[model samples]
Target: MSEKYATIYKTIGQNIRRYRKEKGFTQETLAEKASISMSYLTKIEAPNCDKSFSLEVLLDISSALDIDVRNLLENIYSQPTI
Candidate 1:
């Protein structure tokens, strides 16, 4: 993947995790709510450079967290790029 795309994924992953933390949700709990495995949730929290998460999964995560998916993604892109 290009650095830009990889950065986007990782940054989104980080933001999801940060939000999850603030919301007092654990990986296991979030995974259960998202109907995805804990292992997958872990990956979502720190997605690999080459990994791609589906829109379905992203929406599932956003729903699980009770946050606007676009806002969550927008916040990451708002940061200065290296």
Candidate 2:
């Protein structure tokens, strides 16, 4: 994948982890609630992983977290490159 897209995924993953922690949910709990496999969730949260989730998965995660999808994408566009 391109570097730009990789950064975007990493940012999204960070946001997911941050919000999940804030909501006091374990990865297992969030995965279950989102109807996704724990392994898949792990891949999504792994900063170096190239795997990217679908829009459906993102919506499911947002619903599971009780937050809007935009929350998951917070600061993704504005963040500077690492």
Candidate 3:
């Protein structure tokens, strides 16, 4: 992926982590709620880990988190390129 895409993924991961904590959910809990594996969630949330996931999974996560999919993507384009 390009740097821009990497930054987007990084931001999405950070936002997911933030929202997950705000909702008082463990990674495992969120993973189970999203019907995804814990390891996959872990990879998505890990810093500097630009794991690419499908939109369906993203939607599943938003549904599980009870938030908008756009929320997870907040500030993605605003991230500075290196």
Candidate 4:
């Protein structure tokens, strides 16, 4: 994948992690709430992994986290390189 997309995914993943922690949820809890496998959530949140997911998944995650999709997509470019 290109560097730009990598950064975007990383940022989204980091944001997910941050919000998940803020909500006091475990990976398993969030995954179940999002209707995704815990392992997939693990991969998406892994900084060294470049995983891609669908918009529906993003929406599901956002809904589960009780946050806007923009929160996950925020600060993509502004974040320092992973």
Question: What C-alpha lDDT does candidate 2 achieve relative to the native structure?
Answer: 0.89
Q: What is the lDDT of residue 1 in candidate 2?
A: 50
lDDT of 1 by residue, 2-62 (tens): 5656778887888788888988999999999999999887876875635568889989999
How far is each candidate from the true structure, as Cα RMSD in Å? 2.4, 1.8, 1.3, 2.0
The weakest ten consecutive residues by lDDT in model 4 span 1-10
**Which tens-of-lDDT digit does each residue in 28-77 have in candidate 2?**
99999999999999988987857788889999999999999999999887
Listed in order, each prediction's TM-score against the native is 0.80, 0.89, 0.91, 0.89
Predictions in order: lDDT:
0.81, 0.89, 0.91, 0.90
Which structure is stronger by TM-score: 1 or 4?
A: 4
Ranking by lDDT, best first?
A: 3, 4, 2, 1
lDDT of 1: 0.81
- Could you tell me which residue pairs clash in candidate 3? none
Question: Clash number for every model?
Answer: 0, 0, 0, 0
**Candidate that scores best on lDDT:** 3
| Ten contiguous residues with the weakest lDDT in model 1 | 43-52
